[model samples]
Target: KMHRTVLALVNIFICGCFASPPNFILLFADDLGFGDLGCYGHPTSLTPNLNRLASGGLRFTDFYCTSPVCSPSRASLLTGRYQTRSGIYPGVLYPGSIGGLPLNETTIAEVLKPMGYATAAVGKWHLGVGPKGMYLPTNQGFDQYLGIPYSHDMGPCRNLTCFPPDIKCFGLCDVGVVTVPLMHNDVIKQQPVNFLDLERAYSDFSTNFITTSVKKKQPFFLYYPSHHTHYPQYAGPGAAGRSLRGPFGDSLFEFDTTVGNLLATLEQTGVINNTLIFFTSDNGPELMRMSRGGNSGLLKCGKGTTYEGGMREPAIAFWPGTIKPGVTHELASTLDILPTFAKLAGATLPRVQLDGVDLTGLLVNRGKSQREEMIFYPTDPSEMYGLFALRLGKYKAHFYTRGATHSGTTPDKDCPVFAVLKAHDPPLIFDLEADPSENYPLPLVGRPDLQKLLDRIMKVKAQFEASMVFGESQINKGTSPELEPCCNPSCSPKPSCCHC
Candidate 1:
């Protein structure tokens, strides 16, 4: 009888060890502002579904994107590395845009695909497109791709004017001049459709993918990168003029509905308990001309610069019976998603260094905080926005490029009015606990210890820049035939070695 019991125990252990992993559903909203959601405190905005999600699971108060833009941020999220490391430092990638994710860099989908998870990316895929080898989603790792190659607003529109009034008509608008054709794999599947209808289509595709996976009893990873609340402000037919705020708010409400529909579908299918849903934005809202849709509240600066408004985003993870609900003020980045998902899927990644660390433990444990410090940099060159900022606890330091000036104005030109002279140059430090808004800069007087902290931040910033330069150089060497002809035998010499 004792021998029989031991055999039974061994069988149970083996069964448990070979159990299937949980499915993953990552919902990424395009250009959704931090204050757009109701749970994140939008007095006029309504995000009932997302609010419910926050109540049901975890709401991260201080979550951030790696960059304040799309492509770079998405690249970082997928690879779990800084964009600079993967040569994805920039604004949105055009069809023929040169550099994308390096071939050597592995994505979360690639890691999970081998682990038996069916991966699909539905909605916006702003990484890249066209002839570039690294541009396609299929090349990256996604098994199925159904989404726009870039932002919804990238397509030709009837009106190319500013927001609030610069509304673009769908079918009436001129196509080739303003918008690019929507792509499926490498082919142009359709001309740009109405923004509202496009979203619904995205929802339908996502729902179908999830339902099919559930029916098949196969674990799947759905990357739902949405194209809501971005621009060309037009909510669907039924949702138009629903919000009191404006078209932008109306669009946000529609986005909330999409989230609701997705969640409800999961629950209805009885897969909510076995699925992990992550929701976040590509960056902070565009606070300049597109201020109608964005709300930075008390945070300083807006999109396109390394500031609270630019990088700090609304992040939440919902996995019923798994993640606990409530606010977590831990410092987290989009880069953390790759490693976190990999861990949950029980997948192994190639031996490549990634800047982000897995925060699965912190997500599961209520009291745990993941990051001690984070570095942020912008890739835009128009503003000559060569700046790096480091956040180590409360002390934050902004290191400007040699001749670059600091300014508060959105898209400011002709030398920053707020530029401080070298004599008075000092790192702007704030006690975030007391001043989350960073309204008042800390006085540099009397605190020698604080000065030392600033110095350390600068040192770290220097190291980061050096590493980026070195990586770029290596990529150049690899792509350049003159530099090394034997290195790349089939090399046709792309714009950047990083494109490989």
Candidate 2:
């Protein structure tokens, strides 16, 4: 009787494991702009794979990120809350920084793990690398992690030469202050990771993880945050000279093919029908980098500012037969990812106040997005680390506008109007549906409806400000040279230190 009972239990477990829940793949691009891809009307960048993904799936026109910069933007995406709520506010994290993603916060991986989903986080994880990777993806909930702990340009060990011999890795010698360490789980796999080969490496690692998950008949979540089209662009060998845009386009071109490779992997693994793939950017492009930084399409300004171009991102979702192929102008934010994932995986969410609403209706049923309003956070100094903008339906208002416009910072000839930082008395409001560029602010002289709309938006903003509670500011915890990752801490200064 005992043997029979054990056999029955084993059968039940096996059946449960092979029930085949849907898989998820989140392809997060670093600093990709709203108009950077070909599908988005960029005459050059030539993002074919992404265009194909859009043709066969759902494309979002008015999607946005919570923050306009790196650490904060990423924080909101994973936890479905504002960066201020997650403590990743004010600025990006550095190698010497002490703070990281708080352990108490529940991530998407943690939410799905209980439902028996296998998870992996690949590529740039700027969330945190504090205290010997105590704040890494593995600690936060991912089953396995293999990638850089912070921004690619934040360290040393990047190759001096890229695929095209003409392009050189400038400031490499000076960048030796902090080494870009490649990590797998908690161990530093390589310091000063080869930037040129990172995309290929990430693609290979992701496909392997996918293959393993399918073999086990386990649903998986692969969060692939790419490091391409950022600063100091470097395409892998043979990936250069493919785009009409300069080196930036070259890197983007290579990244698009990387996406193609993932698609091929999905098809080859026979999980194409079951997997749901989402492609989006962490934030808008870095217009400070000028031409190399990427264009914001028709939106205003770029990264590090409270503008439509700064927060708006190009988002695409593909799920074969599950999600119908079409484009939607629904207002969506990265904050919605967590709740949406929870609903899709049939998993319960943590007991916390969430900013993101479930986007499942918008994704599968072609229904409207649950999110109605979005609050944009500042990426400037600690003093300006408050709400920068607000979006309600078709209207967007800027409470405090700052960045790039400040002359000496970085002259951007693209943005003809250089408005310096200032608080708006009535608040600069624009109907995004009519003016996507945010070029024309609706005049209040003859429009009573405009005044009413502004009042409503201001009321929501005031209420949000009055009730919102912020976590401890981890991004401003301060930095120390000792906190930097070192593969071989013993080596000396002449280019050999921290190299393994």
Candidate 3:
């Protein structure tokens, strides 16, 4: 009877039914790749702090982000729903874009707020920014938000024309050309945020929030989505020109150092054992940036494609006394964060259905992951919407194909690869467990059994399509004429311009 009682309590703890709810800190990196960190086998890009986090916690080798780009992936992470279902689908939100993650969708922040958690979002918020700030973090669920509203490269750049009317169509830009404002809550704090110490600023804000939460004895959730490793990469303070991997490497070193600082704060505040930290990237590298971009290592392709490198990201979870230090090849994603956090915080799931699975079981090494399969959506929606990939167990099947070079001049076009997919009788299947690089597609010449795979793939596709019934799409033909970004506007302020 005593053994049975102990076993029951163990089960409760493994399932995240804690007597005291633990704090959460989700450290999200922008455009950091699967192989860019020391623990992930990057020969360069020193990530000692991240490496330490992994050493002291669990690392996921088969983890993924829901999409190959920013906003969609972020939406999935926050809502535990596919971006397609969340209505931020198919494409990313730009500065001043009116549409965003549907207001109806419940975010992880909202889930925890009811549980008495103080939440703060610090860093890039590409979900949406509108005239009344409809899609901003404060409107969503965050108690406070301090950071850039979008990617650093959104503003004007000297190398290319990144101003109004035309810049919306061209997504390429450099730092000096435009000033990306840093915001506090809904208001702009620094117009054209100074890039040199941006990482430090975010780190300091995160640490300060952690300190205050500790003082108040309130559990808090800090969403620190970094702005480094994205295009127009800038070195953080004390890290300029400090990497053998060049500017990109320099930025990573500083970012890792910032992580160390946050960890130190958590330790100093005596919350290290009670806090859970998730370290991962929003998506893979922006290969267009070349040396300035991240390395995907052995994985084929980088950002903006359905390839493993694009969606499969390096992830680590740390909770000193809770999760045992180890590695797992479990299928998990940013989507799982919400459900996992909800369970850990003793909160109820949202009313709507979610695509993510609760990861507490896997996190505590109690059982296999709840997730069995994942559907990969293409980043570029203009080409075709039917194109999707299904990952089941060790195999993945792509219903369509795209050009290999996403960093090409016209990255958005379906170019060189067919604009519309050719009829694939067998579809392209790769055994991911064996071919993580996705360099070879298995031939279906002799195997009648392959039909079973096709049938299963079709079923997955049908379910995904059916799930879209709940979606309230916010995608635009392009950045809406009225919703064009205002702050820069070599154009005057209009009523429709966001944060003008």
lDDT by candidate, in order shown = 0.67, 0.81, 0.78
Best by lDDT: 2
What local lDDT score does residue 88 receive in model 3, on the 0 to 100 scale? 77
Q: Give me the runs in candidate 1 sitting further than 4 Å from their true place.
A: 1-19, 132-134, 159-178, 381-387, 401-425, 462-500
Report how far residue 444 has shifted in candidate 2, in Å.
1.5
- Write candidate 3's Cα lDDT for 73-139 as tens digits: 9999999987777777666777656688777889999999987999999999898877667778998
State the weakest 10-residue window (summed lDDT) of model 1: 480-489
Cα-based RMSD of the predictions, in order?
A: 7.6, 4.5, 5.4
What would the TM-scores of all predictions be?
0.82, 0.91, 0.88
Clashing residue pairs in all predictions, respectively, total: 3, 1, 2
Ranking by TM-score: 2, 3, 1
Better of 1 and 3 by lDDT: 3
Misplaced by over 4 Å in model 2 are 1-19, 156-159, 164-166, 170-176, 381-385, 405-419, 493-496
Q: lDDT tens string, model 1, 153-238?
A: 65446553223233454333323222444555555555544454666777787888889888988889999887776665667765
Better of 2 and 3 by TM-score: 2
